[model samples]
Target: MFDLNTLVRPNILTLEPYRCARDDFKVGILLDANENTHGPALSEISETEKFLELNRYPDPHQHELKQQIINFRNSKPNQYSEQPLEIENLCLGVGSDESIDMLLRCCCKPGEDKLLICPPTYGMYNICATINDVEIVRIPLTVPDFQIDSNAILNKITEDPNIKLLYLTSPGNPTAKLINVESIIDLLKRSSSKWNGLIVVDEAYIDFTLPNGSYSQSMSTLVNQFPNLVVLQTLSKSFGLAGIRLGITYTNKKLSKLLNSMKYPYNISSLTSNVALKATTKEGISIMQDYVKKIIEQREIVLNKILDLKYVGKNLGGKDANFILVEILDKFGKPSNEIASKLYNTLAVDNSVVVRFRGNELNCFGGLRISIGTEEENKTLLYKFERVLNELNA
Candidate 1:
């Protein structure tokens, strides 16, 4: 018999994704992935009701929605003043997930190619790279705060010219810290002339960083300024349209064409496109801004409550986004894997609450990536945590 392992890409043969609902469906008013709490409503749909055709294939170009976001981001001034980026350099996706898959297909050569990733970050980059048979070179954060060491990345890139893509998550997963705008800019400048591949900036959480420390001011502007840059933005977060599965990738025209070609012909359904359009309205998007601000406020509350608890030790929060990465301590003052396991069971069975835990392998992020729920859920978590604290203390 032929060797099957040889036939299958080594990276792809053993891949696992985090266990969550298959799609966006989770608990009430999802803020887990930083989606807007408010969902879509058809207040202005009566006029388009008759024209709404579900069976027809959506415009593969996505001319209208792309321009809508372009205008929303105030990107008109870069292109023709009146025309405002009608097409070419911008493309939409089913979600950032599909956009990620598209990039791997378009760029990476199986086995020979590589992608640079920084972890205590999103896992999808690893998942997609593995599926594509692309090697992933991971450079973890230098410290517990989860800041990237650009020098290490630059050194690695110099050694391995095969690095075709770089995947970085801002306000990174689990750690919930901003991977320094200045750090990214410096890296881009040092590597741009030499590294001719792609730098995909995942701005899924950029919305939450509004009014400060975002690519909107620094790196997003670089897309128009630099040819090698690609900004991957998702309406799932700020637009509250996770259910619609709409995301945008911004780059120079050449790369944009490649993504358009490799992507599924109708990656975004008609329903998804129209829903995304509504979800990204002037008023609706602002609502998300307000909503994220509120969630951040609640995140502070949750962080404070957890920090006050004697069982809770140092946490991974404070830079950006809504989730808190908190470490639980044991009586002997070692890692709280046992306590966390016990608390997870107690919270589930006794308190009807749930929290996540990371293993020692993910040493930097070995704690619950506790999302800032609504005031009620936050309070309930606090209550459940307090009970666990009491049990542990005794």
Candidate 2:
């Protein structure tokens, strides 16, 4: 049996969550929590409808928001679950970063336990491990395709009983490739017998997985089936809600409760919750889907046009996410970090057409990760990118 308590830290299991004033009551005179009853000090003449309740604390539990998210996920065309998502199966966070940090804290025992990560994935997994004083066991994804090395990961997990958490990124950062679902399922199966660790699948770009902006391959559907599985998602990418900093964690009900217990009371602000609530509604989701359609169209346009550049080599990574990773070629027709770095700097400093330089990452030599932007923005990027490559390639 996969025991959640065995995997979690003893202290975290016993830790009492902080209770806020909003927990018990939300109506009548709320003097329990000190606040400016007069409301936010803003211009009375200003449009303050959205920012109306600045004086009152946000709902710590966020019942309505969580229900909306569950409905959204369950309504997806490909989202399958034996027991459909419930409010208890969801936990809200500032961003996926908070959930990552919380999981590290809950499972890893400082310097003793280990957190496994696949290289060229999301950097936050490694950063959060460091912050929580947990050691990282790096298992680099197989080269060229950037797919998971299932055998290698299983071997490592079996060898190290101390590996408390395994972080996998779908449509990964820089790589922009989805780790195979079968591989993930295999890892989860092994955790039952060989190891007892939580498997975190970060799906920040999952909304862009299908052409229709649906997370057809999302690991979220498996959360109800597997207690050890935790799927992380956010509104930052496809939803265009980065400023709000809303992240959703989908897992089993018990694990979700544990995560809720560990989080600070009133973590989700009133403003954020309001915006997120609106965004997850049926109409809001339709708007987000339309945006995804536009982005995918732009992504393809950029991919085809970018390859035409003289210095640009073969495209790297699957174009599952809203970005494209292409190599910079040298005079010898080999991937060149020197040319890539120079082009990255020249574009940002001179042309202001900024993209990421991911040459430093494993197997991503001379790589430039370009995010798909608006139609006009992409045109500008292509124009500037070709101009810079011409100057640098020579």
Candidate 3:
């Protein structure tokens, strides 16, 4: 029912990937691809930069980094496979953005195929679909709880033969709610007939979930089990490596190879690859887990403190991610966008304690999405928010 060849675009399947010089040779005089050989032209460089061989082209295939990622994700409690994930199972990107775009390009024929999304989800899914000339069919999540309407979505999938991708976010952005695993399994099992495309699960904030780093809630391990499943992740969140701009895609070997074929020749830079290598190591993961613990502790403190304020209404979403979404109330105690806007501006411009105002999003009236910061930073945000809310309400 789920055929890989039929799902992918005819153009992409026949694409001849641009071959990089490094794919063939790595040693000897290295005269193949034009290079300075004299090293970087900077007047001065860091001691670490000196050894990176800045003049040479980075590896076209990052074998070492990919292996590290496989080992890290396959740690106990997560059974990715009996054989475990191999290099062919992964595809690295400049960010998850690249892979997201590539999936649209590789599957959807411009102005023909469609993408299905649940509302109050990530904006990029819509943005990317638009850029690729693909239509978007939005089915808003059920009100109050913000969970997926699995039955409704399945009905649509069964009827629409043109829907090529279904994007689901776990620990969803703005909402922070994780979709029920059984619900997802149902979608995967039932949507095989008419909707013959991939079901992409974006788990950017999954590591921030409770019992940090256990990864029991992640759908990445299911990649091996389902040919049509794709899971996207990044080093930006839990690993504290946003500066390197690395993202990962996990899928069946055929899809992974297709993505690799369609991507830029050297998408991952040397600097990014090196930093990510260290961060994916056992010691690096331990350090990251410790930081996640602190963030969760602070998240609770912020949630309890904000709810006590008169102008702050009840929470709008789950507390699964690093951020919390709470409503800002008016003088009459109803959700108010005017008050939320003023507070958002005053906190960032005057108090230097910034948080996002997401009142405009569906079912998120007068809402503010606040990310958990360090202890001192969280304290400053709560103090400023309370002081400002009172001044405006007074």
Candidate 4:
């Protein structure tokens, strides 16, 4: 008999991934991973040089890349602090996904410990936890607003001291809610006036929060005071370098070095590092900000149109991120999986139109999560959505 746990890690022996990229056709020019296929593909000479590096092993310690991320985030060394955060507090991994898994291995023991996740959040955290033999305790967000509940979270953690990690998504996935900063500060202060273990804050969509990141920009500064807190930022969403597969974690020196030591060396490639360096360069920030401004403008236009459609119920979130989560209803108003199914089948006929039906929703079961694309593309989705809604109503 297969000693199943040995083949796959104890936690991951049986795991189901988010149904992203249902097939190759759903993956547009490899954008599913947030890569820039438009990035310069190799010229003849450039191709030859890159091929040479492929022969040698990647740099075990991603030194050059770590320096680049440190400079870009401007962590510490602000006007308030004379000393910059030590370089040892920083390291690079294959992507934020890699960091997520690595941290679980470093902290959570197999089969005995548990991790907490607030649902309608990122799926990867759950996936990583299960594979590590770590049990997942879910705290579903209440309806209408997908806000975090500090009391509920604390109660669960207090009950299970085995809770080693708390995975949170800010500008949360699908929902787009920037969790209350004060609530997070309270979490840092939870228990004996404090807590420990890993707290991974995924800021994947922080770029999309608009009118200048009004809600959560200052929340990150808490890292300096909390030794257990770790923030995962990625070039994927904001820097437009998701293709580089570059993700960053901001934590104290002790945790950072431990994560670095545990990961496979040369996890971050030279090509990826070079691209990430360019992605965060001063010039790059200007371009990214420009794109962000356009996307936020486009996101608003899309939200208004979604509200206009009879099929879409109230938008699910507080409306601060690039994408919006809205409910889809049937004629009798029972949870409408059929309507979402139709949207997927119709849009997928051609790869141009793609919106995700938030699947297996426990609390927000009938919603669809839509990303704002080009002006024309947004209109295409709106038009198709309205037609489908009218048809479903009939």
User: Distance from true position, residue 320, model 3, in Å?
Assistant: 1.0
| Candidate scoring better on lDDT of 1 and 2 | 2
Flag clash pairs in model 1.
94-245
- Over the stretch 1-394, how does candidate 4's per-residue lDDT look in tens digits? 1111332234433333222342324323444544444443444447645643443334556556667556655542222223344467675676789888877886677998788999878889878987888899998865667778888987887777777788889878877888766677667667423344556688887767653333225334445666656778787886777788887777777566556656665577767766776666668777988988888889888998788776667777756677888778777766577776676666667445777888456666677888878798887888877876777578
- Candidate 3 scores a C-alpha RMSD against the true structure in Å of 1.6
**Global CA lDDT computed for model 4:** 0.69
- TM-score of each predicted structure versus truth: 0.81, 0.96, 0.96, 0.81
lDDT of 2 by residue, 282-364 (tens): 99999999999999888889999889777788888888898989999986788999999999999999998889999999999
Worst 10 residues of 3 by lDDT: 75-84
- Candidate 2 residue spans exceeding 4 A from truth: 45-51, 77-80, 211-215
Model 4: colliding residue pairs = 11-130, 11-131, 11-133, 12-131, 35-243, 60-266
Ranking by lDDT: 3, 2, 1, 4
In lDDT terms, which candidate is top?
3
Residue 175, model 4: Cα distance from true site in angstroms: 1.4
Kindly report which residue stretches of model 4 are placed more than 4 angstroms away from their true locations once superposed: 1-44, 47-54, 75-86, 192-195, 211-219, 332-335, 350-352
Between 2 and 4, whose TM-score is larger? 2
TM-score of 2: 0.96
- Off by more than 4 A, model 3: 77-83, 211-215
lDDT of 2: 0.86
Q: In order, how many clashes per candidate?
A: 1, 0, 0, 6
